[model samples]
Target: MVRIDLKEKEAGTGTDLDSVLAKQRAAFNAHTNPPWSERKANLQKLGKAIEEHAEEFQKAISEDFGNRAYEETTIAELLVIKGGISHALKHTKHWMRARRAPTALQYKPASNRIIPQPLGVIGIISPWNYPLQLAVMPLIGALGAGNRAMIKPSEYTPRLSDLLKRVLGTIFTEDEVYVATGGVKVASAFSALPFDHMIFTGSTSVGKIVAAAAAKNLVPCTLELGGKSPTIIDESANMDTAVARIANGKLLNAGQTCVAPDYVLMPAEKINSFSDAIIEKAESFYPTFAGNKDYTSIIADSHYARLQDLLEDAENKGARIRVAGDDDKQQLAKERRVPLTVVTETTPDMKIMQEEIFGPLLPVVASETLEDSMQYVQSHERPLALYWFGEDKSKREKVLTETISGGVSINETAWHVVQEDIPFGGVGPSGMGAYHGEHGFETFSHMKGVFTQSRFSQGKNLFPPYTDKTRKMLGLMKKIL
Candidate 1:
């Protein structure tokens, strides 16, 4: 029988993780391995709660973002979460089932199997980009795997964070699930907690801090950090389709998405044409920038200023900028709704080129050949996602095999993340580990291998002191006699 092994609890910072975990562990002791039916019911209830309060969540997220697009929230956050829960509920039984394992020929009298067990308690630290989904999606996996959980949502989205506290409180008891909301100190304490497993989604720099804290407790973690993901337009690519898709991915969530295309690598000969096509696509996507309810604003003034600083740094360092439409730059700044601005002739010294560019700014670089482009990608920190826009199978295969990222989108952008079946995460500097679908269930679980020996087996043949008869038998076995 599974039980909470909480021998001692560590002192934490400003957050109440210690107290909350104590309760959760105590509750887990009573209901260690929740039956499949119970787990499924939890997921279904969570899904139902989300649907029931969809309008409230939609309004809260919109207010948090200043003016988030309702449709974007529906498609990106709510619908995606519902789909994830459905997928988890559908295959959780298979994920939890004990599977037969192969035994060696010498162990003919023994049988082997592997069983997946919950890891007690898990902690999830979600970022502000997609606040609700990032926080709850990991919970879906943890609950499905029969593990209790605690969540810490980003403090930047106060409305959403507060709403989640209330809604989650109604759906789940404090022992079953806990949602903590606070600033950096609380995050520090949350990260330092002795969780069975922790998953953090945020910037690479912050992920490093979280990793250090988790290491103190020897806590295994999944870091879904962000880096400057790239989208490459091949020489043989369809410029119209490529530009359209890349713009959609970049502009979504106002380019706050971790998997959004940070920059574009297009042929030097077609940089002008590609930039123009992208400008046209951006205008079509957000026809009215200032008052358009469809376009999302930057999360806060500080982020808005950061984007401005990036633009100034790029422009001062001799990068060319193209406005998507006839929008007033000053007014856009005041309103926190920066339109899709494409930068060309970008150099490494520019801030946009140096950073993740988590805004609606696209840096289009000139690459002479695909090999050169791949080389440039390799030289930097590995990114969370890479988008290659081309129809050539050979070229695509070369890029796929030659380079590595957490995930990739062939001839498209940003769609690989919501697929549910594949593991989504990062590599090297971008981040570590993956989650989603069955991979997610396993991430929060431990696969214990079991071996059973037959009672009437010939096990005594090899258990005694070394003798002439045993030596002879060993020799005969070695020679296959």
Candidate 2:
């Protein structure tokens, strides 16, 4: 059985950010670079706690979001985090191994090694969407690398954040893991803390603020920010499969996913057909959106209103927008639900096209040619993810090579972010740095480079300015190496 520290933790864990960081830093000092077995044990205990308390988390997130689908919380948040824990535990030993590097000829009998050491303390700032998963996933990496962590969950998801604090308090000492909650002020304060490493997952605009704050402390950060991820449907694509995948990714959290295809690029002639297919696919998937348990709702009045403004702005600018249950705006509004909106005839001047549309608004832009689609992607800041749907091997390879994104899901969408073996991150405005699986372990680690030299080696021969022997050695190296 995994250990759950049953001692009652003190209240106000979410209030004092400075105390949390100081306590965690002290804890890290007490236990610097914990053994692989301990790290593995930590991950196991977390996984066990999660497995036992999954339903509570699901319910808390549901409450926090007004109506986030329970199944989404289960599949996207809980299950995915469980997978991360398992992966980290399994591979931590190998990840902890010091790698020996080759030495230069001049440094005969000398060797170098790269040792991965735990950063003293890590700070994680997770977004409201997929709150539990985003917060805990990075914690997995920090613990797997033997670093104490302080997580600042989003202000929007108060219930989930509180639950996370309570749940984690039961399982871990505050120093080992802490959750601090508040609105923008608390978040700003948390960002200014002198953490060893910081990870922020949210919008690019806020990421900049976090980055600036972290920079003042000279703390390195991994920014998992949002952008307009594109999904391209080629002429040779299987229309139905493409539509289904896009629908799944976009509608996962009522289109709140950072990696959801913000826009669709397809051949101009196939625009109407693709739009029709997506509307049909969305309807078939969730026959009733607003009152449906399978469908998630907008978390706040502000976000819901923002989505409305985006829709109105798009329509006013001449985009054809279709909601899931067309003509049920009244019902949708009552539930804080916005259906999958397939938008076409979109232009760059529109609000939906300019900003990262964090709702179920798909801006379908007509691409006259494959070059046009690729060029369109290039014109903007790199995306968090890029999806291409087609079987043409050469075209697929071209798209992969020509475009840049944080990740890619060829013929699919959003699923690539969960891979334990790979790094998940973004580029340019999308964000920077990556963390997942062993990559996460490394990201939170300080890879200290160590060089060892044999006492009797000739390394000291070149220590002085102008020795004949040093000249000979340098000449030989230049000629041979």
Candidate 3:
């Protein structure tokens, strides 16, 4: 049996999360199922708010990260969110419509339909990396499904979180969509709330804690956690193209992305060439690391220290380190940027190989054959995303079938996430549940199966106490079925 472990007050917020939840719940109860027009208006308002506050958000996020690229903020956060809102606005009516389900022959003339209904208040726990996107993407789904929501943005990105709270507050009522800002204590309390549903995006370790807290209230959760997402450069892959694409994905956000290529697996023969090409590619992308506005800084001091520690551990474990771009202490002091470092000669025991390298460090592992590459990925926890670059259709098909991941991109990286039509999520420890576009609507809405019995329905035949006639009827029905 699940238990409720909520506290009277959340330490970080210094407010009663219980009362806040009660307010949202009360509002939702008063207006149970909002009409399509109202939901559409809400979505429109949200999109407008995001557009109006885009610069503010960019500034606040940059402050949070020391030196985030403005274009990265625009492209990765604002544009992606607006696109999602546009997609939701265009298709939400259709998504909300009752889906026709075929009735069985025994229940002929009876109509079956699956109705999607709001799940009341949803709680969102978003991470620091891509704070705006992770927090609002799920909120988009919840709103599209006509559900109210409360968001808890990461404390690490306090400025962005505060900005989000203020911006959202201007457009939405507290009871409609509340942004709760605080540290770990507030996050802990927020996760323990008895929400209708919850969505969390962060590391696997923290995801487990949030899942456990939500489970205490028996609230279903969508966990968008991270793992060692792999990139495989098949023998048939064009080294130049693969190298360029991987470097683009891996270096974007300074490799702080959850779905960034954690490591690379390639055939032994191509290791040296691939390494040289990627280093050159990284250098070309950011001519110099120091004072380069195009390059993003790591989020915090601890994170920067953590990346250095990972490198140190790997090097001590006999892994070779190749640094690309200048390593300037001035840049580190000002922006917290770490130049792209590629590690080779990695073993399974090395911390860099074992842990999710959520920084600008890439470990290139050599595999003797495609089977060896496949075996390496399969042996580890299924990743959130996988990239396989090759022109060979047969090899691509083989990788697609034989390997598993939350999502896949062929001949590219991270682009699969922006495709609004498909579901995006992880398979195992990487995460659970998918939400994007229509999938997002379904995740936040409960699909209730409804059957309207016809006046002449035969469903009653199996409802009463069994008799000889009923038994005969059941047998006949079974034969027909």
Q: Model-by-model lDDT, in order?
A: 0.89, 0.88, 0.89
C-alpha displacement of 452 in model 2, angstroms? 0.6
Q: Which structure is stronger by lDDT: 1 or 3? A: 3
lDDT of 3 by residue, 1-481 (tens): 1122332243235357888889999999999999999999999999999998899999998878878889999989999999999999999999999899998887789889999999999999999999999999999999999999999988788778888988998999889999888776788888999999999999999999999999998999999998999998887888889989999999999999999999999866777778888999999999988788888988888888889889999899999999896667675646688888889988988899989989889999989878899999999999999999989999899999999999999999999998889999998999999999999999999999998989987667777787777898889888879
Choose the strongest candidate by lDDT: 3
lDDT for 252 in candidate 1 is 97
Error of 3 at 190 (Å): 0.4
Tens-digit lDDT track of model 1 for 217-264: 999999999899988888878878898899999899989899999999
- Model 3 alpha-carbon miss at residue 238, Å: 1.7
Residue-level error in angstroms, candidate 1, position 451: 1.4
Using TM-score as the measure, name the better of candidate 1 and candidate 3: 3
What would the TM-scores of all predictions be?
Answer: 0.94, 0.96, 0.96
User: Distance from true position, residue 326, model 3, in Å?
Assistant: 3.1
Q: Candidate 2, residue 389: CA error in Å?
A: 0.4
Error of 1 at 26 (Å): 1.2
Report the poorest 10 consecutive residues by lDDT, candidate 1.
1-10
Q: Which pairs of residues collide in candidate 2? A: none
Better of 1 and 2 by lDDT: 1
